[model samples]
Target chain A: MLIRKPADIPPSEITPRSTYVERRRFLGKLASVGGVGGVSGMSGMSGVGALAMAAMSWRPGDAVAEVGAGSLGALVKSAHSTNETPNSLHDISHYNNFYEFGVDKAAPAAQAHTLVTRPWTVRVEGLVKKPRQIAIEDILKLAPLEERIYRLRCVEGWSMVIPWVGFPLERLIRWAEPLSDAKFVEFVSLHDPKQMPGQLFPVLRWPYVEGLRLDEAMHPLALLAVGLYGDILPKQNGAPLRIVVPWKYGFKSGKSIVALRFVAQQPVTSWMRAAPSEYGFYSNVNPDVDHPRWSQARERRIGEFGKRKTLPFNGYGEQVAGLYAGMDLRKQF
Target chain B: MWAGRVAKPSAAWLARIKVALFLACLLPTVLLALGVYQDRLGPNPIEVVTRGTGEWTLRLLLITLTVTPLCRSSGWKWLMRMRRMLGLFAFYYALLHLGSYLWLDQFFDWGAIGRDILKRPFITVGVAAFMLLVPLAATSNQAMVRRLGGRRWLRLHRSVYLIAILAVTHFWWLVKRDITEPVVYASILAVLLGMRLPLHRWGQARTQAAAKGRARVTGPAWPRNP
Candidate 1:
């Protein structure tokens, strides 16, 4: 038998584990020493190109400061939090499916800079007793924010474990004081074409909309997110306000939301409007209920090489599965 | 006559052009390798590589289809010499695409991949397109051409039309929304297919005219020539 010594290995093939393990720390140090200009200079490139450049040059620590300035303050860790190591904030922010900014995964990060998250008001109307526009500042004070790490499953067979900072949607719904007739709650996103360039095209219905059953909306698991990674939300990740419905597909969590309407009828979401057969009203995450174009049984978790078995209700079935009770997930999916 | 009127490059010039074309075809793979080496493929390198290789496969297939039309329009008969190489490059990228899916995306989880190919329409069509290309790629050599004879080989190669359609449909069905890129490729494929209609008719008409001329010269064939 022939044995090769450690010294025989080429230096180029061996990257010290410590160098990669402390890569973010090294990048953070690099950022402090004039790496900010490189990130800013990448803005002129195409969306995916810019994201690639940002991924290479920008430090994850500085990304929070550059985008949100840590406006969210300290968050209490929730019992509902998953133990999984959440995807890097760079991955969560840079690779988004916020179609308001653009349809491409990287478009939101590149184009959402034009979005004005401030001076934002969410109109709480429809079946609510008091139909009025609430300022974002007032909404932030509704409940104590908590960090709940959850698995976000996209319909495209990709998944991400995100550490989201927000309070329950039940708090916001209770604050609104919905009438008894309110059976469903529809979330509507901002619709300014100038800010969200993708809205200029009719790829999806303008002013993207999503909805949930009254019981689903009242579920403690449903979160009204304002921030992520203990920082205020980046414009690309739906700044000001967004919903995080962990049990459902990621698209169900509407971003850059400007309105929350309590309605009696099941709202026709933008996805449902575009392709009724593919996207349904009750988009609960189910591995058994495969998407028409691809399988939902397995998913490629971002930053990971191989796929893992996608769980039913994204592995929150114990808590939220009761909401669907005896319904057919396949038909709904 | 028009083809003769055009200037043909010398053997050395043609060889250099072939070399350049081969390198040009290999550029995407080289860049992809550099991306992997530099760790510039973003958070999901497998997804990037898969998508990149798949896209290049479609692009090269479209470029391969364009060669015939270009030769017809420009009377550059030499262009056809590069078609098989372009087509094989497309096959190479397709192999890389499948390799990424099997090795990187699925990690050799044959059961999962089998289920996906069976259950998913996108995967089914993509795999079908790749499978169809296998025989075409296998027979791309001059030895196989001589073994099968030109007519049978040509007939077998015609399946490329079906492969192209399946490849486009694979892309079209995979997208969730915003079908702009797929639409653009589909339109190019449509134009290429449409161009073949007129060329096929022209070839048929020329063959019929030649047959008629031959018949006119060999009149009264029923009578004994001796």
Candidate 2:
């Protein structure tokens, strides 16, 4: 199965923008003939953004460089970006699951869009050999985007399939060059309620921390994401930065992040600290292991709520199950 | 239960009960506020905590009300001062419960929410109890009772009996299966309702008739208090 690469971004097309209205009229005029804009630019097939991105030929070098991880990467070798602009699909991506703003799952999405991401600095600290503040842009420039379509399973019995554009956390951690004492890495989301109104309510601890065991952090499947759905990660989603750990529950994937600390011990996690019995630090999405108050055996797949069956390991169990060998997930969970 | 003050409240008795009631009412609010401030309320704790507090408030309100009738026949008027604060406490928790449902659960999805209010039987009864409490809550004060006329306000607040019954039904329907808690609440409600019956003479008449029938068979006691 061909997975989506991180940069399947519609290069120049503005499908949902106000400018899409004007472009639609122009595309209408073009399609009035024998469809001169070619198959990729056809509005009837791919989204106007995808088509427009396809239509406009970037500089030769830029084209090869940007589209290097093309066609949704390994997930879908042949699938093209559809014209169906379901904002709700994108909406859920932007909206659900961030607690830096509030404990309510959707509050961060509603409140976090106002965050100023530029001029933001991520402090790399703790057991790292070179503890330094790095700009988010500096981190993004390190590796060209790659595609990874991971199944995201939330603790609240919901799941989603997201095509994320990111470098592997392993890649970034290797560069961070932590000392031998580094046994874990913790991530902290920005905690200002002046921009994130939900933080003002004191739902969860302000910074919303998440951590990974050193081995887990260095695991190749762990992703350090900067964007999704072929665009800069929307402000509600996490804006400039976030983490995506497909094997674990979604909370382990911290959002609106600003700090990465390689630590010597198990780091503080947001939900686990909020209620230890209910949310464990090792929040692996296991169907057999039920949350203390709720069941994890079933899940609502957001858009396809009633229809979709929540598969074991969100359908990626074959890829990630080996990570949790002989260990009993229920106990760790 | 103070042996000395049981006969009469005296000067400081009402004041002491007032202090106790005020603290009981204020402490929960303080703890909940601190939990909110310190990020202590776990994810999705609003629903559980809200309902728990409301259940406690309603149970306490009934207990406080029962005190008056308990003391009247049992001569315990010292129970009076705590009733208002307890009733207000019920209203306070009810307000938080409603706010949680509105802001957190519903997210102002007004149309779907309105449909749920109409469609869901438990929600209907819950809303009915909530609506009934509003008038009782508004008329809680002596000033409001004076303004509305004490007798009229008393009649209006009598809706609380109906509210308690609806509350029991709401609790019963909310739990999918295990109803041990609701059954306990229902038993307490039954006792509170039963207490009002003896006050109305229906129960007294039944007891008197029973006593008279017994007297005809076994004769009266040799000595009486009178």
Candidate 3:
């Protein structure tokens, strides 16, 4: 392990209340400085290229300084601290990492424009008292977007600090009132290969699926993001709706969502079904549980120059840490 | 080849066709290299270039292999003249594709690069294809041909069949999804192999039947005088 000294940073350390107002102020400045620039300009694309090239190496805490506490907001909630929410999760319901439309990380930002997010409805059925179709617009009106900058980790071992905008997922589940039989919440994405080229892959079937334990789904850290970067959710980023589970690998927080089903048994996930030995539920980023192939100890924090130290529960241990206090993460993994 | 060198050159039309065929074999490689240099190889240029060079390498090899049957069947002996050039082009792109992976992905760090070549299944197959190409490339010249003689030269270059198979396997393993491209290359290779079997048989049968009928009549002198 490489030890880093925070004293290396030239500025005063941030502590106490890291509030929404402060995040907004910082976000505004970061938009001008840190953003690759709005997707509209060619300079912005070059900016992405330039960053990808320069970021081959890194200095510690560069992301925290640039993007702010990133996943700290949602993690703080997971940490069960009411005082701080993530500042980077500016608009969470939408910003996503779907690459089916194209290969560019930013492609989803534009390619998702081809998708129709309206006139949308979700069939919340299976072991639920309220097995009904709910208009997405009505669902949006259920609660206003709030900020939760969650630590996002990918199976590929890279990560990003995203400030997502949405209400706690538990809020809606409580209002819907699942019966005692409901044990899992399975999510389904739009599966058309014509729309999602990832489906055409003989490697893995399309219409990606994800699931979580009902109790885990209700955990305060789980969110239904509505927007990002202070804008309505971009279509490519699962516009209109998506889930954010702050502590797990990114795939568990599925994208381009079309359905959410409450099931009694644990649902089979596509990645797990494709390669069972490699992926597992409770895919919490436990540094001790190495993936079949890679080390989970360190991750490339995207939007930052180099790799960062991975924390227990992605640095959210103060709250949800005790939830797994006695459990063996390696077994669950 | 010793006696053939003393014979007059083939017709003018044959020479022009040989030149045209060489240009055709070279054009895609030149275009692909241009695409690589300019970073115009397409979105995810590394993956695109990877697939492109690999596919062309297999295709040129198939064409070079087919020259034997095509020349025999069409009775165009001149078709053999273009075979060596096409075989070399296949090697040229195969080397470029392997070099790109080493230079760009591995950054030429011999240790990690060696680990990738040794540890990964796909990389191992790809390296095997490259090693097979080395003998074919070396013997492609006239001096080596004279030294090895035609029979030994043909036997050594038979490694082309195995190289094409290994290249296809390398392609199949690299893709995370959509193996249609690799499957298509595999199908073409299978057909190219099929074209060789009856071809050598039919050519030899024609040569021997002429000699056989004359021998049956007079217990073996020559055919035309009778």
Candidate closest to the true structure, highest TM-score: 1
TM-score of 3: 0.65
The candidate, 1 or 2, that scores higher on lDDT is: 1
| Better model by TM-score: candidate 1 vs candidate 3 | 1
Candidate 3: tens digits of C-alpha lDDT, residues B174-210: 6544567789988988888887667557645765876
lDDT of 1 by residue, B104-168 (tens): 67778899899889988899999999999999999989889889886688788888999999999
| Consecutive 10-residue window with the lowest summed lDDT within model 3 chain A | A3-12
| Candidate 1 runs further than 4 Å off | A1-69, B1-6, B213-226
lDDT of each: 0.80, 0.64, 0.64
Error of 2 at B47 (Å): 15
Best-to-worst lDDT order: 1, 2, 3
Candidates, DockQ: 0.23, 0.02, 0.09
- What does candidate 1's lDDT look like per residue over A1-333, in tens digits? 122122223323433323442464344333222322222222233545534654576454553343344567777867777666566677788888988888878888889999998899988999999998889899989999887778899988889888788999999899889999999999999999998888889999988999999989888888999988778888899998899999899999999898999999999999999999889999888888877777788888886545789888888877777777788777877
Off by over 4 Å in 2: A1-89, A103-106, A305-308, B1-226
